[model samples]
Target: MTVVVGTVCVAVSCLIQSDPVAGLFGASTFGLVSAYTALFHTPRLLALCWTAAAATLTVLTVRWAGHDLAFVVSSALLVALVVVFVTFAGRMTIWLLDADIFHPNLDALTGLLNHDGFHEKAATLLTSSSRTDDRFFVVAVVNLDSYSLLRSLAGTIGVDRARIEVARRLRDTARSNAVLAHPSDSEFVIADLFTEPDTSPLIERVQGTINAASARLTASIGVVCTPLAPVAKLPAPDVIDELMAVASNAMYNARRAGGNRVTYVNDPALTVLDAPPTDEWPDDDTR
Candidate 1:
């Protein structure tokens, strides 16, 4: 739309007015259009629009500046340069804005999304599934059991290594469409779609993966699988928060009962299904 409008304006100014100054002034509209494209559209579209603008400027300049090759070339080149400059400035502004918005939502150590990023992604996921009733939105919070003890025993470097390893294992276990976030130093969150209400298999898989990280390392995992049919009308952020809250509480319960286990909650009423105890944490002396 912008390209078409810009081209039409330039053509009308040059053909109807018959004044070289008016034609050049009207051609400047392309620069404005280019700026808009650079900010909101892709670089490919911007390039195509600028090419059309340059071609129009050249053709119109030749018709207006008759028999003067130097004047025509210089005028066309100047307008093209102005359009290019505007596009470059606009693109730089877009780059800076994107970096500012997304940098804070990334975990520097594990390269996963942070808390804010998780919320944004999960909200989008819920919004997309609002029209569907066959899917379940599963939110799980995984906490590294005895993490503080590991940190105290091995110091910062070992703790960082353990977190990275856990992140890797979770990434491998989660589905392709899952949204994973490292919300805290020892806790990771996962949100994904499931076809069934029973997520015990997934919960078991997560528990197994975390336990595989190290003999001494185990995780307390809490999960809540919500059917989209009931909460489709609710706000996505609210749903996400409720799910996370329930999942976090379940995780805390798991931790309180024992360090390494899986807890599941399927309803909003906070009913909990605790998994049987898994491999016990090795004695501190074993570390």
Candidate 2:
């Protein structure tokens, strides 16, 4: 929209001035404005098209204003240089902005989203998924059951190494598009585990990654799925907190039974506790 306005304004200025000097000045102004505007807001194709059109228009303006061949050549060269400047400056600005946004959300050690960042980014993803035919999403938290034991054996340095290794493995084991978060030392959460099938294999794969990290390391994951049962209809960001808690409870249940297992819980009411076992509760209706 701004591009359209800028382009139209430049053409009008060129037409009204009807002088060679005015034409050259207008071309320069247009080039700078378009470049900056495109950098901030316009699409790549739009920028490309605008650059071509502006160059052509500049030559035409010079010729229309009765300028000599030398002036026309100069105008074209100036316009091209302006375009190049815009491209370089715009790219640098974009890179800096992205770094600023990403640095805040990332966990320094694992380079995964911190708890707050995970919720923010994952919510955006879910909103996108909501627009599609997909009816369900999965949230799973992988907890290292042997974290304390690993620390006891490996010490702080060894523990950090193990965590880095585990974080990498977790990143690899999940689907390419999965949103992963590191909320605490021993906990890693995954969102957009979108497949609706039984989550057992998924859990097993996560556990396997941790076990592979070290002989002393094993993990239990708690997963809670939403809107799969007729009674469940979970909403965005708000529902995420509830689901995480329910999944955490299920994870604890797995911890209780012994570690290195997967537990799936569907808590429609998002209950902290008092969630019936999977076999006993068919739906999320909680009192």
Candidate 3:
């Protein structure tokens, strides 16, 4: 869209201006706008390609409008100036945006991706993967069942240490393809997708890891996976939410049943869709 609009503007300029330099002025303006837009939204190599294409078009328009060689060279120089200026401006703006927006994606406690970072990576993976390849997600909610009791008995420091240990166990258990995030103090949410591989072994491994962490702590696990049986496709955001809800429901069930178990539900509709199990967490822990 940016390229098309800029090309059209350059064409109009060629038609209205008799002088080569004047004809180039319009292309220069278009280049400046395009450079800014591309810098904000496009990769460096791609932006360079766009600038080169625009410069070529500017030269053509000047020649087509019957300008002298000196005038054409001068117009070409203008395009170069636009490229240099835009490149520097775009680089600076992108750096600022990255620093401000992306730096906070990691969790401070666990050194894992936080909620925003998890969402960002999940969206990217969901968009890139195709349903044709049996691509799907296994959204897992792993919570320390004994967190409240541990906090009561050992105080804040002990609970923090236990949380960090649990997070480390989970990260170790998850495969390289998985994305792990610490969304809450006691709960560590993990997303397994992209590879469309079996999650059973990994789930079992994670459960075992947490169970062996400490006798005082046990993890309640839940998962939601896709391409189960009937549903081959689902909207990205809807699927994410539904899976989270179902996994959450299973985790709640696990917590209700004494807390040291792994549970998963592929079909969310079969599960109770009422208000999330109120019995799941204490009031202070509401996200």
Candidate 4:
């Protein structure tokens, strides 16, 4: 679309204007089209548009500027340079703005996505998976058990180290495509789409990983899994929030019953299932 529009505009400007130089000036309107592409489209498309504009301008200049080879070459070169500058400048500005905006969405200590970042990425993932029949969305909320006690004993620096360590462990345990976030000092959230509905092995792996981390850290994990078929029509943000809420509730239940346990909830009714105790980590005191 950009190439077609730019070509037509360049051709019309060159043919209609009486002065060839003025016609070249009029064709500079292609910069507007280039600007649009730079803002909303990829760099590749922007480059393609620029290339087409340059070619059209060169061809028209040669045909219209009779006997003046210098004018023909100089005018085309000048207009193409101006368009190139505008397109690249606009792209750089957009890149800087995006970097500035996304900085706040990351946790400073753990370098993980914060709550807002998690919501944005999770919503996008869910929306993309809505049409897939075999995919399910899984949301897990993890709270480090006895975190306050650890903080008091270890002091600020120690607590920060522990948080970083826990974040690393969680990152290692989670799948590559999972959206992992450190929303609070003691809480982390993981959301992802899975082809298989059964997440028992994943949950257990997370529990085991946290248990193995330094500072004797154990986490209460709450998970909610829902098939894409039932909630495909719902808004992605709302669905993510609902699932997180249910998972948080289950996490609280696990913490209340005894920490270091996994609680699973199956949505949309939000049925809670307390997983049986595993002999792998028999010590309840770690919870």
Candidate 5:
């Protein structure tokens, strides 16, 4: 659309101005405007192009329409300037939208995506993955061992500090292929997709990083690879829900095993599906 509009503008400019320099100015203005419209995804490059084009257009307007005070030409140029301003503003608005719509921070305690940003983006990623056959994904749920006890003993401020530390650790551990969401105070979800190989190793690396990041703190991780046993014919939403359920079950097992290990839904030991369990701190007793 931008290219076609630019071409038409150039043709019109040539018809209006028979001078070679005037036609060149018109063509260049059209090119710059079109480039700014299309290259908005690259902020630095778009900014350069926009600045140069605006300068060019200002010079051209001054050179051609000076001392004329012609209402028609002046009005057209004003309209064109407004359109260019709106175009720049549109690009900026999209950058803001990406931040607000796709990357929300979740409160570690409540288990909800703190803002709607993560929820919307996660849903979009799930939908896109479901449509592509070439993609396989896994969800890993992680929880800090006995994190609530710190909240109780140290007070709300202490708990908030711990949550921040945990979030920082998780963010550092996030891979390019992983989308991490906090679903609860103690729990985080890592959804990995678009990679050629399985994500088990990445999960392990993240688990190690988490353990290393917080001294005297450890995490119990539960993983659920999609296409689990008894595969489903249902839609992608159903499949994701099933994967989440499996991850929850694995989390339960991790807690049972003392909250310092990683467990997968397919782990043979999880077959029995024993009673509900509790998480306890190690005997370090450090506040």
Candidate 6:
């Protein structure tokens, strides 16, 4: 709607100025073109089109009219338009892609790592951690308590608003080395980015942060030690499947135990506990 109104405003301004060329020079036109391309074109195609258009326009102006003030002005306008379009288009494209990747449904309250983003990033992290024997890493799965009640009482939209608030709090509380992603409506994954041997302190810090957020908003976290026993014979991606499964189980135990506690599978208490079973859940419901 903003794009449409801006476009109309640009058209009207051009008509008032009686300069058909002014339409081409207006920022609103650039904004409109950028919005249109973002809605329709893929990133690669958008880049190619903008590149070609810029080149063609510059070349045409240089050849058709000699290198004079008019030629310079046209060239400048063309360059500005291309830059504006590309800059805005690229930014919006990435924002939309990330939204699709991490916050698809936009209803993820307690904004933790969504499942897809967690697996993808956790795998990458595991691959890297495997190379350095000295480095220690951890994957923490966070499960929110009574999230269904929150949604039911506040409505889905209200739940979403709460999620945004919670997400911001999580970000504020996350360690410098943490990679946070939401994998479920109320679950988040935090990948510790520490290369040092001590990660327990960092994990504690994250847990404390979440615990401090709201008395009503409690989180049960499961930590899985990465590069699980029996070091891989093959160099693989930086994700440890065993560790992920273990952390997931710990999260399940946390949930089962009334939610709001940090549990680690490697902990003595969970040593004999069975791994959490998996439940089939919808991958995406983003409108």
Highest lDDT against the true fold, candidate: 4
Arranged by TM-score with the best first, the candidates are 4, 1, 2, 3, 6, 5
With candidate 5 superimposed using the best TM-score fit, by how many Å does residue 74's alpha carbon deviate from the native?
Answer: 52
Clashing residue pairs in candidate 5 are 108-184, 108-185, 109-185, 111-183, 111-184
lDDT of 3 by residue, 1-287 (tens): 66556646655665467665555555556546555666655565446456555655555654655546676666676766785577577777877787667677987777788877887776565666654666556788988886778899989888888888888888788877678888888888888663454577878888888878863577898887765222323344555666778888889988898888878776456322333444664688565
lDDT string, candidate 4, 1-287, tens digits? 75567657666766667676777766677777788888987778777777767766876787676758887787777887788788778878877776677587888789899999999988888777646467788999999999999989999999999989989988899999999999999999999877778888888988898888878889998998888765555566767878989999989999998999989987557322232323554687888
Q: CA lDDT of 263 in candidate 5?
A: 87
What's model 5's lDDT at 53?
Answer: 50
Model 1 weakest lDDT span, ten residues long: 270-279
Query: What lDDT is obtained when candidate 6 is compared to the true structure?
Result: 0.59
Residue 129 in candidate 1 has what lDDT?
71
User: lDDT of all predictions, in order shown?
Assistant: 0.80, 0.71, 0.69, 0.81, 0.60, 0.59
Q: Where does candidate 5 stray beyond 4 Å?
A: 1-119, 130-132, 194-198, 227-234, 266-287
Stretches off by above 4 angstroms in model 3 are 1-102, 194-198, 214-216, 228-234, 267-287
Question: Candidate 5 residues 1-287, lDDT tens each?
Answer: 44445545555664467453454345445444644655443555444445545554555555556445474356446645664666666666766776566534644343335534344545556665433355555778888888877777878887666666667767777775456677667777877663443566777777787677544568888887653222222344545565677887888899999988888654232221232222433456765
RMSD of 6: 13.6
- 65-144 per-residue lDDT for model 2 (tens digits): 45477766766677667756776677778767776765889887888899989988777766665344445667898888
- How much is the lDDT of residue 185 in candidate 4? 90
Error of 1 at 115 (Å): 0.7
Question: Which stretches of model 2 miss by more than 4 angstroms?
Answer: 1-102, 228-235, 267-287
lDDT score, residue 277, model 6? Answer: 23
The true-structure Cα RMSD of candidate 3 reads: 14.5
